[model samples]
Target: EAAIGIDDSFYRVGGDSISAIRLLVLCREAGFELRISDLNNTSTIRSQAARALSDDVISAPGTTTQYAPFDSFDEETVQRLKDNVVPGIGLSWDSISDVAPATPLQRGLISETLRSDGGDAYVTWKITSFGSDMDAERLRRSLVQLVGSRSIMRTRFALDPILGVVQVVLKEQVGEELVPAVEYCTSASEVKARATAVSQDQRWGRPQTSPLHIQIISAQGEATSMVWFSHHALHDGWSFSVMEQEWRQLYDADGEKPISTIGVDVPFTNVSRYLAGRDNEDDLNFWKTYLADAEPVRLASGSTSGPPPPDANAQKTITHTTKCDLSSVARACAVPPSTVFLFALATALGLFADSDDISFGLILSGRTLPVDDIARVIGPCINTAICRVRLQQTQSAATALQQLQADLDEINERG
Candidate 1:
């Protein structure tokens, strides 16, 4: 029925991966074993219907007699349903209780906060574009609406009087200055210097404030650069990317887009709730055994100590970028480009550390849970996994790559 006339394209009419999953659930309940891959490849109703009836369709694994129907809802709708939700029933469309568990990552952040000496960690992204029409006032309006609509954008911390643990709190309304903080500089160098200063000097306003901020630099009137600053406690790399994409969409549309389209997001508060209730005994055991005898990473300077205590009042960062044929490396290693990049990164760090035995933390997306529309739950939603790779003096590069691949797969599967 959603197809209207069979020729309609599912995606052209606002159908997305979430809707496709919902359709799959509905069809499965009706005794149709449809392949999700087939649905993704073909957008029209006729093709999907035909594919559904054909032998090419494969049944979804782990069949059950009962399946939730709202599983088909887009990320936004699912998240909206979670806000002020009732407890106990779990992932339903009807109104329910609103208690959520704090996630493991949130717990760690809370621990850091309790220590009181925790330094700030913020992710910064700067975009410079030319020959474009971007209205500052319109962008400001979009930013304001964006902050008001998402709970994570306005989330803050408070001490739970009874438990003594820091509690995540969502405000009913946030009225932060939405206009991008403007800076004027005569040259590009000054612009960069001023932006860095803002990123370093700005804080998330002492516990009871939003962790996200933005600044717009109008440099020389020929180039406009926007710097997005977000505290790591509030967002991860994935969340920042999502926000940037939406920001561009809003700027391009002159803020005419509906809040429903641009602003529906999973609240970090819910993530904290869900994480607080996870059972990770097995995962803990695995890590303990795997890295029982691993030594601390050593640098070429023969110092294994971490970077000098971060200057609380200043920001220091060093970034280097060089491009190469990553796909070629991926092909040689028989792994995806992402894995290849990690392998290369570990190797480079191994050289810097002056040791063949390397161990470092890898960030996971934390979306592989039982929660509905987990991908849309926008907060930190980031978990760290330990990556350990042992290199041999005479081992072939291909062999080392294969070993790294095996280690990564094990960590992922167990985590």
Candidate 2:
């Protein structure tokens, strides 16, 4: 008889609903009566195997059920959904400030991007009730209403073809309900303060490309919430924080009028326009000169896992985060914080690549320029800059920082 434990290899180990039904059918064919519910109750493969053995039945190896691979929506279907559905936008903030509402053109651009991208967003939370009296439905409703009122919380859908403008709509549901709240003895004030802090921390450094995720959980009868903003392609950290404050205010007010409307208008279109006008020759030269004799380094073992095989719709993504202390950063070539950050990031990538010929992408904020002002509205305003680093045997961290600082200074000056 097979042992039963968490590590046991069961046919339904990671099976979804459909696979569960098929497993039941196969068990019946093997002269062991089983139901889908039985599999749910006995989640482990070992447990099921033990049950089968006790039933005095031997099952064929090939008869074990396998989960069907997930199918992704095709580009055409995704495009259609983009044309029809509005997507959620996550923003961030450095500090709270007020600005004008999104212009019609700005809104349109955001809508178009989301549609093409298929705007599926999520937020998770843990809820705790302070008093013995707690209403799950009421709390849920409050959260819904809070997100519904904000312009940022409203999903943005595209309206125009050429301009790709977006229109806003409130989301109907916030996704699945997780576990119920755990009871504890925490003051509401302490809980709220902690939630606010979490909200701030959850803001993304790069807020345009990734989707926003909010996580909430209850601790000691206090509710804690963590809000995640999408990548730099859609919004920024500053804008996301503004949205969080609004959500919290609305939640605490029990759906009262918002405290105030303050936002920033950063010129994303202008940045795109500026980058488009730049001479490709200079950028190309920068890459060539920096990486001419360098060989491409393979950072991760699977870094060269070339594009997925033909007709393989499965998608894969790799995320890496590296940090350097302030002292090390300051000491590196005596560069500023920004330069240190860029240099360290480049160095990390170079180390990961383990080769000298690798090219990596970095995101830069367009709001760095003075003319751009659209700060309150959520949209993609970051530009991608590719750098080719030459990892020579004799290159030191300070040398790399000096080289990067020079390259960055050139880019900024030219811009």
Candidate 3:
């Protein structure tokens, strides 16, 4: 209910690491470049601007990688994966360029969507407003470049008999049609609604088809809004920041060259391979011990016996006013506002379930993987984690907050 001033703090206003990526992208596009760590340290717009753009010190972005398929595996291994994956779908061996493992989360989402058959769960839409800066044709070219730069945008997900879920990356020549041609409308609102309709349509419910749909709505030959329809598996909050940064550069930084000339430094497929190949023995064991005695906090809606209920098709948004100064509370506890919010969430859930012991699902960025330049790495690189908290009757409020803070710190370090 409050407007954020330039001097306002991001986290204090409820920003997180993932949103910080988006903030940085918007800043760079507006002609001021900043690092993620800058927001982690200060988060206020003026301080960030002063420090980042001093003496026109915009740090140059890293170079993008060219089209090199499946460098992690040997030529023979990649070819074999392609061979096994081809028969599962309708693609031919010659049309397949390479193969990579799907991100664990993407695999789960695909499975759930397939099981449910149809719903708005995995389908996502993103709209970004643009002025008449780039002409219609140029904007269309940028969309093409966007598809070509990232393999996930042009790839298909297939369940391989031996390898489980795998991403079948098609040859560039074959995947060129991944991005839909630009569509027009008299008004920006009409285009946005059209894009939403496209997202809600179940024609592309299966994962085998291309998961990307785009509409560059132009009114009177002037670009207005861009609608990006994608399966949740293809992108995350982090991916949106990465994609927008590259997309803006398509017509700005590399305007004179062909879109095909550019590529991502770390393709989504490469990140997936790294994530899938990691040894999770320690992680698994830690979670097993951590949640061994934790009881899930669920709504006490009487009938708890039969198989779990199906997902409710309806959606609702609830808003509440806490009437508490969270910044003061965080300062008293010697923790960040986010930590305060975490404890608040735990306390609220415990109260709802009428249980002191509670366990909840938390979404982690998975950006902590030991990969190089992970902060800038793209894709749905997210992990679902269980956060367990036991609030003892004897403990003081401050004591509980400190304990939760310690647990969160450990989780961040481990991830």
Question: Which ten-residue region of model 3 has the weakest summed lDDT?
Answer: 59-68
Best by lDDT: 3
Ranking, lDDT, top scorer first: 3, 1, 2
Candidate 3's residue-wise lDDT over 1-415, tens digit each?
5898898766556665556545655555454555434543244778776776566646445322323556656767666666666666788777766777787788888887777746446877767667656465577677687776666777778886656778877765543466556677787567667666665566553577757767666664454666667888888887787777777778665565544444544567767776666687887777677778776667664235577557645556889865988777765655567767878888887777777887887777766554445566667877877778897889987778767766764565444
Candidate 2 clash total? 55
Using lDDT as the measure, name the better of candidate 2 and candidate 3: 3
User: Candidate 3, after superposition: displacement of residue 259 in Å?
Assistant: 9.1
Writing each residue's lDDT as its tens digit, candidate 2 over 1-415 gives: 3444564333223343334434555555555655433433224666766877787555453343221111123456444434443232331221111111233334544444445534422322232323424433344445455443333433333332432433232232432221123223266666566655655553322223223443343343334333333433334555556555654454556645433322222223333333433467876776666556655445545245477466556677999875657544543344445556565566667666544455666554433332223233344444456565555668876667656655654444332
Candidate 1: tens digits of C-alpha lDDT, residues 1-415: 3535777554335443345546655665455664333332134788777766765444554342222223323566445434423111122323221223445565566556545554443333444443335554556656666666666665444333232333333432442453444655676666666666655554633333445566666565444556665555667766777766776666666647446467555556555544544567987888898898887786535445677555645656889988887656655445445566677777888788877778888876565443444455567876888888777879887677666656665565455
Question: Can you list the residue pairs that collide in candidate 3?
Answer: none
Better of 1 and 2 by lDDT: 1
C-alpha lDDT (0 to 100) for residue 176 of candidate 1 = 49
Name the best candidate (by TM-score). 3
RMSD of each: 12.2, 27.3, 8.8
TM-score of each: 0.57, 0.38, 0.71
